[model samples]
Target: MSLGLRTLWGWTRRLFPWVLAAIVLGLVARQARMVEWAEVWVAVQSLAVSQLALAAALAALSYALYASFDLVGRHLTRARVSVGRSLGTAAISYAFNLNFGSLVGGLAMRLRLYTRWGLSAPTVGKIIAYSMVTNWLGYLWIAGAVLIWAPPRLSQEWLPGALVLRGAGVALVLAAAAYVVLCFVSRRRQLSLRGHSMELPSGPLALLQATLGGASWLLIAAIVWTLFAGRVDYPDVLGALLLAAVAGVLTHVPAGLGVLEAVFAASLASDRLPVTEVLAVVLVYRATYYLMPLVLALPAYGWSEVAARRRSARAQAVGDAPV
Candidate 1:
């Protein structure tokens, strides 16, 4: 790459997250204008304490499962960090990611934390790559199964035809299967792309990744289902959530703020469940699952960062001191 182009690219990478955040904030503001805050508050207030507790518990479990993503990634990358540290990094990074979206929230946070823990840039990169792959592997598995078995009614409108949805499901499953096959067949377990060499985890590790990733999605779906309180069946809600999640991710908006709501409101709303109720449920889910964790994570992450910097400074000073 030319110097001018490389510098431009560097600046773009640094600035992209902020730009994305601004755009998402604008979109969220627009969506907020459409919502009835009073009604949403009433719906939230009306929720049973037991149900709210259940949802909170499920959300906790879902996040714990999310932490496992990093655990698996650490193993795959052979990072020497302790399990507790891995879990903390995963939880805090995901908490940020859930609110700030992927690029700035998750990846940036992980890069900072893992690097501070003595991991090289390449190792951290591998961990991030593995975790991302693990997440999507599970998403494809569940989404494929749900689409094939109890295809959401909304698919007919979003997709070209019923058969297309089925075909897509089959393709997704086959793609996942192919990854497993590659793990088994390729002894070297590596891929080379554009001068970069990437190593794939062993078959057993890959299988574990798929399992953990898939379980995380299942638990998350359960959380959503619990929030809905049987208003809709599990399969339908899971399918809708998967679709909405994909849409939200594609938008590159922070936490998929407005994009997620729009997709869920469109896909999950029906005669039996009004759009208002769906929106209310979504609001509660976002607050509990996304915002709450972020509220806790920021301070904890800040402390860790400060501590790491202090340790670094002390080490440098000690090295410079005359004996």
Candidate 2:
């Protein structure tokens, strides 16, 4: 990379969070005007306390599963951190990643925290890469299954035909399966793609990644399904959520704000679920699944960052003392 290009890339990295925030704010403002607040409120209120509690519990479990991915990272890097400590850090970073964008949340925060905790930059990078794979393995399988057998009621504008959807589904399933199969059969410890190579986790480790990943996706869909009060098919809800997730990532919208709503409305709305009800349910899901955790994560994340920096500084000072 040229010096000017490198400088430009650095500036873009630093400024990306702000850009994402601006986009989110603009999208929120536009969507806020179009939303039917009264209907959303009614839908929100229709949920009984017991149902809400159930949804919250599901959300908690889902978050726990995601946090456990930190263990995979720990194992991959052979980091000396304890399970409890790793889980705590992962929980905080995961919350930030969900609300903020991945740049500031998962990638940056994990890099910052793990390196402070004593891992090198390359180790942290590997951890992040492995966690990402573990995170998405299940989504691919779920997407494939749903697309092939139980795709949502998307309009022609959203999805053209079952054949195309099924083809895509097969591709997804094969891609996920191929990873597992290769990991199982390959005697080599590294996987190469293009000119880049990744150190492959052991076959059992790969299997664990698939299982935990699949469970995480299932738990997420279950939370949304619970919020939907079982009114919609579970597969349809999963499919729509998978679609929203993909859209959110592609659009680079923070937490897929507005994208999820648009995708869900397009995929789920029907005689059974009017557009308003669909919007309302998604709003509640966002609150329960996204906003609530972010509320709790911010303080801890800030405190940990400060504490980690201070600890590192003290250690550095001690090392540099007259000897």
Candidate 3:
């Protein structure tokens, strides 16, 4: 086989899994009857400006938390990239992640921009890795908080599911921390620290970043819950949110698509919130998290594409010109 054909085959191999995952998720969503477009439209229309604003704030908070991870990663690597660069990449990457099933699409976009800014592949890889790690650490933080706060927030009868969720949260936290320590210890200096001129500090500052990063994610969750404060009555709003998060992770679907809806429905139904309301809240969440970010991303994507093509064309013309 030709080298070009082999490259094509490899690309196809990479895409097959995403295609398969999408197909399976679509089938499950269909069977689950999770999508009722008419109802979703009604819920959307009923939303007041206040609720919409809260939802937007939630979306913004989520993005902020994400961007914070990039900032933390940059600091760790001692990279001189500006916060604005981090924010731009976060927006573009998130937009792609929401629409496309694979996180790789967004990561690819990030890598390209960072490379254009003179970042090396190892630097890019380390930034991406640290950002993801910090994000998950935030999940552990929220989960732990929900477990501790749920019982006090709600009645004793409502504590069972909360307990189960709390247990899971604690387990995830321990596992994630253990994994990070192992990676740090095993990799040592071989670990890609990016192109930072300064070495990452070991003690207090590192601890602070991880802690604040986790707190930022919880703030995002609070923003989401605030949007539908009166619409749904889960025993523990925070706990349910975290549970939905866990379900989303388990689904491995981008933006937690069907998985979020399924887990949300099951969790709310257990708490006796109406199916219609659960669907409503979930739809609102998606509108804020997915649709809004996507609309915001279009212009940035277009500009980036145009700029990139122009650069590519100039490079090619220069290469082909008579010397």
Candidate 4:
């Protein structure tokens, strides 16, 4: 890309979060003239406390599962970071990644934690790459399966025909499978693209990453479904979550502020499940999965930093005592 085009693209990504929020607010304002805000608030209030608790439990499990992504990365990089520390760092960064933006959580947070643990910048980058691939690969696998076998019924025909969707699903599976195959056969697991060297894990490790990704996505979908109280089928809920996931990434909205509500309200709401209720469910889901984890991560991050400093101090003392 040329300089001008690249600058415009950067600006677009940076600004889209605010733009998306504005658009969402504008739409809500327009709808407020027609829909009763009181009804929406009532629906939100109607959600059971038990349902919210269940969502919170599921969110905890999902967070635990995702921390393994960094473990896989540590394995790939052969970093000396301990298992407990790696998992804690991953959990903390992943939480921030959801509540904040990738710039803060994924890159900066991961870098800060791992570097404090004494890993080089390149080693940290490898770990981050491993975790990101694990995330997206699994998403492609599960999303492809869902789209092929049990695509959600959208209220709007904004996308192309069902046949095209199925075709896209097939492509997704093929692409994911191709990745595994290449990891199996390629002698040199590293790839150099645009001055960046990406190292792929072994084929078996790649498959493990995919499994972690698929399970994490499934848990997240389940959390959302639990909040919704089965207003839609599980498949439909999963599809809506996937659609919102894409929108969240594209918009780069912090904590997906309005993205989840807008997407779910538009995509999942039907004659049976009203838009207001869908919005309500999303609000609770965000509270459970996004906000709660972020709050917990603050303490976890502080402890990790403290532990890293102590470990470093001990190592320095031992080195100085040697004769």
Candidate 5:
């Protein structure tokens, strides 16, 4: 009945479905012989020093993409929060996104930080919304490029598959772009969505913010793809990595575990890439991109939580000491 217990219960409940989904996918992969344990081990052991260096660089790029959120948030609010504070908040959000499954938790944390810096609530909401728009638009750009340029690398018989993918990718890009435009054009419109107030960010400034945000995400994809090529067995760098990036977004599972692997496997598999190579690629990609960041994030998350608790305790004590 305690708040702590309730929080724990809530997290467990939310996690159960995703955990089950992962188990089902794992079982299916096993049945299909999609996993070769030997290849996984080899991939891990075969990683060279150069590959490790590349992985580190890629991680730095990923962190750089994350910093854009804080940059944009501060610029939009025109607040006095320093770049260092923004970067710290960004790191905290990255840690949250890895553990908590969605950008919702991370965005909420960012909003809270802005609030502490005296940003208006509505402005913070607008900034966050635009930020999402930016990131999604950037993703669409890469997806579009992949769909158009990638099919030539696959077999002619797979033409229909390529077309279907391209169509879907194009649709996703247009839909996301349209949403941002609508929100921008209708900013002055006060509306209710199921009784919740909705404010539109219909402005040129909003568009600019979204554009910058999208560019930041593209930089992140470049980092991962750059590292992924060196670390894995996939032959088609641009196409395969683009598909993996798209899967990362669509999967919505924390860190895009199942979805990314499944897409990475399928994209390469469709091109008749060997299963052994596919597993090698996926394993290395996951190790450097997913696992390593998680390990680093644990310590960062611990430090942030400790600092947050201290700040809260101090505020509470100060409130209680007043006459």
Candidate 6:
């Protein structure tokens, strides 16, 4: 690309998050005007203590599953790092990614932590690529399964018919299957693009990736469903969650912020569960899953940074002292 084009692309990527946030907020504002705020508030407050505890527990499990992404990445790349450090890095990186934009926040955090732990830049990049592939692999698997078996009712204005949903589902499943086939077919187990090479994990690792990734998404969907206290069936909620998550990711908004709520509200709008209640559930889920992790991760990350600096300074002083 030309220099001017590159600069423009950079600027576009930076501003896109804010633009998406504005669009999501506008849609949400319109939806908000349709519902009574009091009812939403009452519904949120009505959540039982046991329900809240269960949601919290599910949130913990969901993040633990996320941490496994790094474990898989490390194993694939053969990067050496302590288990505790790897888990911490994954948790903190994801926490930031969930709040800030993934490209800017999550990648930066992972690069820093992984580098500090002695991994080279290239290895970190590969780990990132592997993690992303693993994550999306799971998404496609779950999304395809949901659409094929228990497709939810989409807005007529958006999707014209059930055939389109089924076709899309088939395409997603095929895409995932293609990747698996590629992993097995390639003797070298590597792919090169634009002068950069990427090594695919073993077939066994790929299978594990699909299993773990799918399980993580299932756990996350369960977290959202638990908040509903069985108001909606698991299949419907899983379908909607996958759709909303995909939409959020495509928007490139930080943590998908308002975009997730808007898509989720639109997807689940019905007489049995109004948009307002759905929005309320989404807000609580975001707090428990997204914001809470960021809150804990920031402090833990900060402490690690400070401790590292202190240790470095002491080593330098010791080295410089006369014997």
Query: Which window of ten consecutive residues has the lowest lDDT sum in model 2?
Result: 20-29
lDDT of 5 by residue, 204-254 (tens): 655665566556555554544554454433235555656555445544556
Off by over 4 Å in 4: 1-35, 155-157, 305-323
26-48: candidate 4 lDDT, tens digit per residue: 65355446555577789889999
lDDT of 3 by residue, 154-262 (tens): 3333234556756865786676565456544553433434454323434454565567667766666566576667655433555666665654554576777766665
Give the winner by lDDT: 4 or 5: 4
Candidate 4 displacement at residue 151 in angstroms:
2.5
Question: How many pairs in model 3 have backbone atoms within 3 A of each other, for residues 3 or more apart or on separate chains, i.e. clashes?
Answer: 0
lDDT of 6 by residue, 137-211 (tens): 999878988888888787674344777788888998988888888887889877898999988877777888888
* lDDT measured at residue 237 in model 6 versus the true structure, 0 to 100: 86
Model 5 residue runs over 4 Å out of place are 1-32, 77-80, 107-125, 151-160, 169-217, 228-238, 241-252, 269-273, 312-323
Whole-model lDDT, candidate 2? Answer: 0.83
Could you arrange the candidates by lDDT from highest to lowest? 4, 6, 2, 1, 3, 5
How high is each candidate's TM-score?
0.86, 0.85, 0.72, 0.85, 0.68, 0.90
Mark the regions of model 6 whose C-alpha exceeds 4 Å error after superposition: 1-29
lDDT of the structure predicted as candidate 6: 0.84
Alpha-carbon lDDT, every model: 0.81, 0.83, 0.65, 0.84, 0.61, 0.84
Candidate 4 overall Cα lDDT vs. reference?
A: 0.84
Superior by TM-score: candidate 3 or candidate 6: 6
Q: Report the Cα lDDT for residue 234, model 3.
A: 37
